[model samples]
Target: MGGTGGVALAGGGAWVGSTVAAQPAAAAAEAAIGGLTTPPAYAPSGRRPKYRRATWSQQFQTSHGWNAGGTGTASANANDTSVFVRGTQSVRVTTNGTGKQSYVRRTGMTAQNMTGKMIRLVFRVDDVANLSKLVFYMGSGSLANYFSWTFHAHSTTAANYVQSGEWVTVHLQWADVTSAAGTYSISAAGSPSTKTGFTDMSFAVYDNAGGPVTYRLQAVELVPDTATVFPKGVVSITFDDSHKSIHDLARPVMDSYGYSGTVYNIADAIGTGSFLTVGQMRSMQDFSGWEMAGHSYANATHTASYPKLTAEQADDDFRKLREWLVGNGFSSEHFAYPHGAFQKTSDGVPVDLIASRHFTTARSIISETIESFAPAMPYRLKALTGINDGSGIGGTALSKVTGAGGRLDRCVNSGDWLILCLHKVVEGTPATSTEIGKAGLTALMKAIDDRGIPVLTVEEAMASYT
Candidate 1:
């Protein structure tokens, strides 16, 4: 139910007893690997590092000397104590309506080697509608020599959509680089990799919606890519909104591949328009072994405005939703934010302060990266972009779905959990952007199987973390 819907999310493989008389061959293979009651553990490949520490960080304190791009304006104020995630002040960037690339840039620094490094940025948008792509740039002092990596903070097609006026953290990995020029990617001359160092940095939010827009930056850090490869990675297929098409279409396909998924259902919407009925969910749960999870209350909007609610209100909303799930004989151990919107409460308490008290694991559609085995924030697990017509293996044929640029390879090579978000599954052409054709779903499952990766439910994947 998020905006980004192109890539995978979390999980590999888990087992479920099917009511179908003809058990899938994949099921037997999965059972042989102990996928029946428990997820199989793969030994770490030890080809990559296991720890990550900040190599460089910025707090926007003092005279940071950041400048705006093109016709935009940018400044840092020591006394601007309005919103600060780290310190007492933050950098404020205002875009001019004329600039296509509105950004804040700072140069004149000693070159820092960023090979195999990831960039982290914490920021907030005054109006999400005015923001296009969230881009990060690294340069070798010369403006012409740089690499740009884009994050999905505002992309409507991406799974992880950061809400307006809410603090969001984005991790831009090396592979996220969309464009590079000059010495950014040296021609096979670097020792470890062809990637070069950077002496300049820029944070950008595109102004695609016209008019001047404002955003704030709290912190930025350069960290090592502590992701590692395992003997086999895991994939968790997840469906949001309890769309009836998922049960009528996706479930049978996944069952054929010996995979059961986690369903985040809106409690109040059960048996409502286009939603799965409780009886249908029961069939999937008891017969297909699907895990029923919480989405939100029935009358809640597609996206939750948690930051607008007081801490007490947020807690009540979350509690009622969980209670609805449990009261209906569903597991309330996990939850997905409605439309992937989560942030601090209106009273300034972090959303996790309230969410952690209700659910064991909280998943957010934020990061495009795979969730680590031991996630840094259990309550805010990163999910890849949604698997939809535009972003994921949806609407495409099997070959294109398992193309050379598939995201599943990253999981297979990194031993991390990839949580894939899906909304609707249709047998014919998709009528909406949220729907993926049956062929696309089948292709994705086959791709995961071809790589010999296991699929697990969210619960199974979290439990297999050890």
Candidate 2:
């Protein structure tokens, strides 16, 4: 699980790793992801930007002699043919129970500074039956200092993690990785900003299924940094939970920049507590060109997790929420999972399957990175953590909004999409991870304006790009 902010929003998390012995090759399946052949869009028509080869790369075609760690319950096998994104084999790891930390480790590598580099992983989850989470780590010798990120495996909110038997490509920025969860902890000196030099790395996956669950890794690489500038890029500014402060504080700043964002409104929270009233939403939608999207149905406090509901209950909730939004004269084509939790029900029904019945797209707080224009998984649309006033793994300082700006810059440089998630906006100072101060919001809007990046509503982006 990623680090959650106040209420339902979150900050940071990382991924999984493992190693296995070589076995006889199996037939390679044709690549299911079509975006790979799409030439890197970060360069000009005639000129190609050069990217230094990966400081370390593994194809998993044969045994890399990496060390495996975790309880005896977990194991990995290489040269597996059943699932792969490239080549004829991948490393498959099977495990049961949560926090088992099943992984393969590669140590004694030449030290490399990963300041501006990106971690690239190609993996697949074929069964969501008992899966809970995936975690990855990098540290120095003797496993003393390190940082890691977690990926939710049980969530049906993300398309890539669904049991669709498709390989997904994920590129994680150095800044997005954190040691928020997992049995192994990240020390202050182990954080990404402070710990750039590394001698070892590993990937691990944990399951809550009680039975067996498996995930396959085709490749892992550390792509070196390069100067990039794509011909075009787009950003979608989003406010979740329908907080009244969004209308009272954030809107004006964004409007001044000629921007319009999407608001994910809890159906039952309108006009109650600190949430936006129906009239306010309408004004923001019609007068400000904002899009009103669906969130949880009966979440009056706007803190409910949909995955906790029974499949029948969740389906009814989605239906009623969409109906309420459309009946109130707001677009219901887009949605955001409450608390960023869209894991499947105990019966193995993915929340996305239900969401697709009501909304065209459902956003999830999966990571902090630029989303692909052609998202491999639309329902579980990946997003950066909420923007806030604190300083740490997931907070942005009000005095310097460059962190937010850097994300926009990455989108522009790669011709990708950036979906920024925020919860509430308030006056003076923000007191929680779920809230950003007015000054912080204004500075972020200014950063977007200065970059000259096109700002689109969720519906607009999907209609135009997907």
Candidate 3:
């Protein structure tokens, strides 16, 4: 009555559509004789040896060209034994002006079962123009019918692969595959770097004759049913002044990739000519994951009012700004000192009266990691510069926290909040850059996420402290 392997017996008359006839006498006797055996014993609840789930993943490194037998031809290379399992057919490669081919088969060796799996491919290239292609085949097809993922600019023009050259890593993820067609995703980076979002993707490689082609190839890894969680950590990216570019250009990009930042608004600066409007500030406050804090009224000149104003005068200024913020539907809990300057008494209590009442916490400019500074008051930490600048944290900047035991590393080790203060997000600005951009900030956030710290806005972080 069931499909496929259904059992049927001879009927006395014509057989009915849904019914099965009785078994013969000899068949019934054999079944009854085999029913008295004991079942096998098996362990129920004991621990088995733990093996890495990643062992089934595959990795390949190729230096020599795909040419086999020292004869330059596009044919199967027996000596060159680089193989890919399913969804991959022939390896059509061109290296140093010469073309060659190799075949991937599951013979004698164990082939990786990557059905419905997440995989990553990292490719390292020597030059940018040297083209390398990886052909993927789903059904029984020749190189003309398969999809070719190619990488263009490569450094080497010879048979031997160069090590210290520009390389790219390609990531491929496979989903469902059917008789009709299969689905997959791919991403490529200049080096062996992992990214959250991918672009330049051509899905469903339907061309059949070398479908979608990418440039370079380094290494490929398969992550089978594994969950990659971003580590938890606290990273504070603060931008002083109502810099709309930080919000308009940087914020969207940050949010697009799941990151949050704090924008410190100088109360008097908003709605002024070159600054963000009050409406923009309010919009940022209502932004799903962003926070707006105070950057002081008019970014008060340090040379004029500071180091001279009595505690009372400072308190009045603070109260005026704090009341304005609250009236404007903004939180007055977090404040950043103008010019990174704050008046302090002999005992180190901030002399500004508003420091005691209006603000929950304050921050100042103290670049690099200094263990002696207190985290509770006037949180002194490095401020990020614009991207590519030698001053911003991350990247090739030695002044920033790119090296070992840098500011970010120290902050992680101490489990302290690392607040990065910035004046502007525009280029050609002091303590900032024009071309160097928020990508550095993104990198820093990723680093913090990697180190297992929780990133919170100024207001959110202040709430925890309180």
Instruction: List RMSD in Å for every model shown.
Output: 13.8, 11.1, 26.3
lDDT score, candidate 1, position 162: 59
Tens digit per residue, CA lDDT, model 2, 1-466: 1111001101111111121112211111001111122322121121111223566678676666665557724666755665554566677777755556677667777786665456667666656667666677777764566667664455544433434343555655443454633234433322333445677777777777476677777667776432122244677889898888888888888878889999988888889999999999999989999999988878732455776776667767777787787778986478898877766644445666456556767798866445544443566688776577665635544433345335655454434567888988879777777778788788778777877778889887766532
Candidate lDDT (C-alpha), each = 0.63, 0.62, 0.40
Q: Which stretches of candidate 3 lie over 4 Å from their true place?
A: 1-233, 299-305, 344-353, 367-374, 378-399, 427-436, 449-452
Off by over 4 Å in 2: 1-122, 125-214, 218-232, 300-302, 390-405
TM-score of each prediction: 0.65, 0.60, 0.43
Better of 1 and 2 by TM-score: 1
**lDDT of candidate 1 over 261-340, digit per residue (tens):** 99988877789888899999999998988999887764554455566677667767777777777777875478787756
* Model 3, span 1-466: residue lDDT tens: 1121112111000111112113443443223222212221211111211212343333332332232221222333322223221122213322323433322322122234443233343332223243333333322221212223331112233211112221222223221111122223222211111222221111111111232222223233444321122112246767776766776666765676566677767777777777787787777667747777666664553334333455445555566666767778865366666655553322322332234345555565533222111131232223433334436444335234534555555444433345665544433323534333556545655665666666667666544423
Worst 10 residues of 2 by lDDT: 4-13
| Alpha-carbon lDDT of model 3 | 0.40
Per lDDT, the best of the predicted structures is: 1
How do all the candidates rank in terms of TM-score, highest first?
Answer: 1, 2, 3
